[model samples]
Target: MPKNKMKSGTFIAMCVVTVLFIVMPLFLQVSVIRNAIAWILSGLRYQEYKSAYLGLVGGLLGSWLAITGAIYTQRKFDREKEEKRAIEEKRAKEIDKENIKEICREMLWSEIRQNDNSLSCDNGNFIKAIMEKNDCYFYNRDSHRITTDNWNFIIDKVISMDLELAIKLMHLYKYYEFMTDFDGSADSAFTKSQLDFSKYKECYQDVVEYLEFPWAND
Candidate 1:
C-alpha cells in the first residue's frame, strides 16, 4: 500500500478523537455522570457539598479545555511539518533539473563549436537559443558531477521521443566515461582506432533540441 493510503487511518482516528473530545463534554449533563462526579468530590476539604461540587466541575472543565488545546496544537504542528517537507522536495527536484539542463547546453555547444567560433564564452546568444528550443536540463559531466541517475532519465526521455538519439547517447557515454580520466590512460599500451567525432557531436545537438520541447512532438 502507499504511504499516504496507510496514513489515512491515522488521520481518521484523529478526527474521531477530536469529535469525542468536543461532544463528550456535552454529555456531562446526564444525571448519572453528574451524581458520580458529586460523589467523588464530596470527601474533598470544602466548606460544603455544593462548594466541593462546583470546584470539581470547574476542574473538569479546565482539564477538558487543556486537552482540546493540546490536540489542536499537535495537529497544527503536523500540518506545518508536512508543508515544509513538500516544499523541500520541490526545491530539490528543480535544482536537479537545472543541473541537467546546464549539462545539455554544454553538449549542444560542443557540436556547434567547430562551425561557429563565436560559440566561445564571449558569445552569450547560444544559451538563449537553447532555452528557446527546450526546457529539460539534464546533468552531464566527465567526473564526479556525472551520474547514471540523470543520464538514464534523459536516455528514457529521449527514447520515448527519438529512439535514434537515445542510441547515440548510449554509445557516446562509453567514450565520455573514458575521457574523464585521460590522465591515467595517457600511456596506454596500444593505439586505438581513429574516427571523426563530428557526426556524433552533431547528434548531441539534436538530442538537446528534441529534449527542449519533447511535448511539441505530441
Candidate 2:
C-alpha cells in the first residue's frame, strides 16, 4: 500500500482499539454495554464529520492559490510580448529609413551622368509639364502648380554650378511647398526616372556644400 494509505490505516486501527479498551469499560458502569457502545459510535461519527469539513476547507484554499498564481503568470507573459512587438516595430522603421536613403543616393548619381546641356530646355519643358499636372502654381499660394519647369531650373543650376542658385530660387518660389508634394510621392514617376542620382555621396556633398536646404539635414 501507499505510505499515506498505510498511515491512515494505522490511525483507524488505533481509534478502534481506543474505543474498545476505554469505552467498553465505561459502558460496563451503565445498565447495559449496548448504550455505551452506541455513545462511542456517535462520537466516532462526529470525528469523521469534522475530518470531512477540514478536508473541504483545505482543498478550497489550495484551489484559490493555484488560480491566483496562474493569473499572475499570464499577465507577466502578456507584458513581455508587448515589449517585444514594440522593439520589432522600431527596428523596422530604422531599416526603412536606410533603404530610402540608398535609393535617393542612386537617383542623384544617374542625373549627373546622363545630363546634357543640349537637353536643358527639354528638361525644363518636362519639369513644367509635371508641375502643370500637379497644379503647382508659383505666384498663387493656393494654386496647385508643381511644374516640370521649376524642377528643370533647379536641376540645371545644380548641374552648372551646384545648388547655390537653386537654393536662392527655391526660397523665392516656395520650394518648401514643392518639396512637400515631391516627398509625398506625388512625383514618384519623375523621381524614379528623371531625377537620377548615381554618385550618391558626391551628389549629396554638392548639395551640402552649395544648398541651404532642410532635406540636407536628413
Candidate 3:
C-alpha cells in the first residue's frame, strides 16, 4: 500500500482505539473493568506515574512528528520530480518540432506548390467540364503526379503543432490517393469530382502560410 494510505489507516485505527478506550466503560457493566480504568487514571497523581505518562505522550508526539516530516519530505520530492519530468517532456517536444521544421525547410515548397497548383487547376477544369455534362471522354492528366512523399516523415509530428494543418493535409492527400488509384476498387472520376476541391486549395494555402514564417524561411 502507498505510504499515505498506510498512514491514514494507522491514524483511523488510533482514533477508533482512543474512542473505544473512553466510551467502552459507559456501555459495559463490568465493575472490574471500571475499577482498573479508575486505578490507571488515579495513578496520574504520583510523580512516577506522571513521568511515565509524560514519557508515553512525548514518545507518541515525537513519532507523529517524525512520520509527518517524512511524509512531507517524500511528497516534496515526488512533486519536484514530476515537475522536472514535465519540463523535460515539454523541452523534448519543442526540440522535436524544431527538428521537424528544419526538415520542412530543406524541402523546396515553392517548386512543389507550383506543381500542385498546376495539377489541381487542370483537374478542376476537367471536373467542371464533366459536371457540365460534356460528352468528351475523361482523361486523368494528374494521375502520375505525387506530392505527399516528402511530407510523410513529419506529418505525424505536425499534428502536435497544428492539428488543423495536419487534418487538412491528410484530407488533401487522401484525395490525391483516390485520384491516383487506378484499381477497380477506386471510385470513378466523376464521383470524385463532386468533392470540395476548395478545401484542398485551402490546405495548400495553409501549408504555404505555415511554412513561410520567419523561423521556416529559406
Name the top lDDT candidate: 3
| Lowest summed lDDT window (length 10), candidate 3 | 179-188
Highest-TM-score candidate: 3
For model 3, the stretches where C-alpha displacement exceeds 4 angstroms are 1-45, 108-112, 122-146, 153-166, 181-190, 213-218
lDDT of each: 0.48, 0.44, 0.58
Write the residue-wise lDDT of candidate 2 on 1-218 in tens digits. 96545544555555455445545556677766767556655654677775686467557555544554455456568768988999998787666545533443444333432221212224444345444344332222223233333344444534344334445433323432333244322244244334432222344445433333334454
Q: Rank the candidates by lDDT, best first.
A: 3, 1, 2
Error of 1 at 152 (Å): 16
Which scores greater on lDDT, model 1 or model 2? 1
Model 1, TM vs. native: 0.35
Candidate 1 achieves a global lDDT of 0.48
Clashes of 3: 0
Clashes of 1: 6
lDDT of 1 by residue, 124-166 (tens): 3322323333224221223222223345556665555445656
The stretch of ten residues in a row with the least summed lDDT in candidate 1 is 184-193
Ranking by TM-score: 3, 1, 2
